[model samples]
Target: MDTRHFTFALRHHMVADTLLLEFHGELDAWADLELAPRVAALLRRRRRAVLVDLRSVTFLDAGGLRLLLRISERSPRRKGRVRLVLDSPQILRVLRITGVDGVFTVLGELPVPFAADDTPDDTDVPA
Candidate 1:
């Protein structure tokens, strides 16, 4: 319900069929609820792949992490893949400590280079 201090920008690379969702500002408890539905709707669009560019995100709590996990789960069932572009040590530590790091493929940084025929490797993604 509250949309203050939060913004989301989406940019797609048609060549690689990757949807880069850049999240800026805060992703706290309140924003988590509102943000998830939007993300879910976008995922349902059959974008082929989703790359969440969280590098610009200033903060992400447990709720935000949950949202990512949920979306990751849905992407595969819908015949797509999800990758999280995150470089923050805080987020990395949290994901690692909680054992969710293996749940999602965490890219080292943003602007991930992809070839036109890039395809998800079965070994690297979740079932």
Candidate 2:
């Protein structure tokens, strides 16, 4: 399980070629700032699949939602894609209320055999 702890609120590990992020605390403005640099770097990498697990999150706010939406913006048609793994009622309710649940490819569990390609191409990833 190769992983890097981004902060108290976010921790990420790699499975196969997919990067999985697990949230432990509030992913508000603070976590958004802390995670931006890393996410920017990943976006620069072409075809890097990202998976976010939010089942552990107790709270969901706009700032956090923005971050998730940003990550999900990666083109799903290519190998560079983002999927959300969440089952929290609180989080689901927030997504539903915000009408964002339909915006993402939500999954109940992590996928097996992830898709990862290290070759990255610049894509105007905002930092």
Candidate 3:
């Protein structure tokens, strides 16, 4: 196997009260260094909600999975919700195999904005 370091990129924005974070490139150990602090900063701001867009993430490992879990755990205490948007089959499989899929509100795409009382249309990952 090629022992090359992986890199990751992040693009984020606010839609209504939700903070949408888009991840690109491999999400591995190396990428954690770049991602953790940024995410921490965002969390510190106490955003009402967060949506992690993983459509462009090409690779994920245990570290990456842990990071996602950490985000999910923290979001609720901050009075926010965290949803994940995943499009890659490989990434999806990893989550399923690890049984982490059930721990998150995974979606195929970003849900349409809805009032607190209204149910938004969302694609849920299969169990």
Q: Which ten residues in a row have the lowest lDDT in candidate 2?
A: 118-127
Give the alpha carbon lDDT tens digit for every residue of 8-30 in model 2. 35555566656666666676776
Alpha-carbon TM-score of each model against the true structure: 0.71, 0.70, 0.77
Query: Could you report the Cα RMSD, in angstroms, for every candidate shown?
Result: 8.2, 7.3, 8.8
By lDDT rank, best first, the candidates go 3, 2, 1
- Cα lDDT of candidate 1 equals 0.63
**Better model by TM-score: candidate 2 vs candidate 3:** 3
Better of 1 and 3 by TM-score: 3
**Candidate 2 TM-score to native:** 0.70
The prediction achieving the highest TM-score against the true structure is 3
Cα displacement (angstroms), candidate 3, residue 125, comes to 29
TM-score, model 3 to reference: 0.77
